[model samples]
Target: MATIREELQAAVKKLFDDDKIDYFVGYAEDYGHTFPAILTKDSDPSRLTFDRKSYDNLANFLPELRGSRVGLICKQCEVRTLNVLAAEEQVERDKLVVVGVPCPAMLDPRKLTEGAADLDSLDESYWQEKCRRCLERNTPLADVFVGERVSTPTPAEGWPLLEEVEKMSAEERLAWWRRQMSLCIRCYACRLACPLCYCHQCFVEDNKPQWIDKSVAPENNLHYHIIRAVHLAGRCIECQECSRVCPVGIPVDVLNNVLSRDFAERFGYVSGETAETQPALTRYERDDKEDFIL
Candidate 1:
């Protein structure tokens, strides 16, 4: 059995040789950090790697490279992101050749590193919380599989963090979130890292109306996060990239996760599960509850 790296190298080399794709997106190590890279025909395919340390969702780079034929190394999460992009009609599916890898989950660098250290010593305990609830270890939309299928454990209950947050009284929850929001420096790293935040003119940047305060006030930070969560309410795919990139270590995914759980419970809808499924907020039914209306 070939390792995933070898198989991906061969597959990408073939794609390049056959001129099937103009670019290949995969992971590479640089300065001891695993980051996503775009490979060309002239680039070495051996640089392509699959590891738990690889955290960037390669699909986030797709919108920038639109109109070019692309071969993407899709982990389960990236596949789900692509599905969401497809749902929003942000991408042309025919232009993409997906090379899927069964995700082994991902590790949080903050847990294993003081500044910058090798991940060789870390165990699964340091893996991201998202992996514990992952149901898509196998690529559901792979055009080609590059490795042996892997299995992941299912948690006894889902949305444990959201449940915990809900258990807090309203005032306590408000105080808790304000503490978290106060840590934000208003750097848009989360917005820049999010694939779904593809807007060319984000509301935060509008000088005409100045929708969100540009200052670093705690209230402004809370407003930004809440509005961002609302924008992604029906579309967030739980990739956790925003939380991963937050310099202040904010648990930014919690807001999105709460909405995702509500969507699942109320409408029986899961975002990014399939491209064909309509977004929960996009369509309405006559029988839908209207109790929330004033």
Candidate 2:
């Protein structure tokens, strides 16, 4: 397996030499953990450093460079996010230089900082729960991909947490979720941090529709999140950014993962596989399953 450092070095060097891109959007080493930074000049090619702990979604950086050519690092989930963004016209496909990498699940930031002495050491931190049952570790699409192609265990086995929740009574499930939602502050950090939620005017921010109230009450918080989850239903790429940015440390992956699981099971679908593919909610079959819808 080629290390992230090596792959990044070679990719940046070539991108510079070929003039394939004007900027490199990848991780740069910081005090301890890596941070997302851009390398614009060829003389600064040395700035591109990718390591095991490079976990932020690079797709989140694309919008700022809307009309320009740029190189981006894509792990499995980032690729899904990018494809969805591209399909929705949030990003320009022609202007992007695709760089794919193999992702070995991301470490939970909270768990990593719990007992870890240094950031580099967190490479071995306990990964987020969603990553435990990840279906893809490496990106499936790229113009110039790097890293040894690895295999992931079948994702069809089913999500454990979702099943456990399903085993609960309706009131029990509602109570469980109420506690989690009550912890939220309605900060909108999860929505802002997500690449998929890149709408210029978010539904929550709309005055006319007033899709959700801007209050910090539990009802408002739960309403906002539930609507956010519904809006992203088939469109969510499962990048887990929504969960990652949660201040209260709510396991928001449970929401996205549930929708993703249903999308796959009910529609035989996976988000962001292709820009040409219609999103799960945007299209439907005449004889589709609707036992619960009615």
Instruction: Compare the candidates by lDDT and give the number of the best one.
Output: 1
**lDDT tens per residue, model 2, 39-64:** 87645655567665677888888888
Clashing pairs in 1: none
lDDT at position 19, candidate 2:
82
Q: Tell me how many clashing residue pairs each candidate has.
A: 0, 0
- Candidate 1 matches the true fold with a TM-score of 0.93
Each model's TM-score? Answer: 0.93, 0.87
Where does the lowest 10-residue lDDT sum fall in candidate 1? Answer: 115-124
In angstroms, give how far residue 84 of model 2 lies from its true place: 1.6
lDDT of 2 at 230: 83
Give candidate 1's error at residue 62 in angstroms. 0.7
Position 199, candidate 2: lDDT: 76
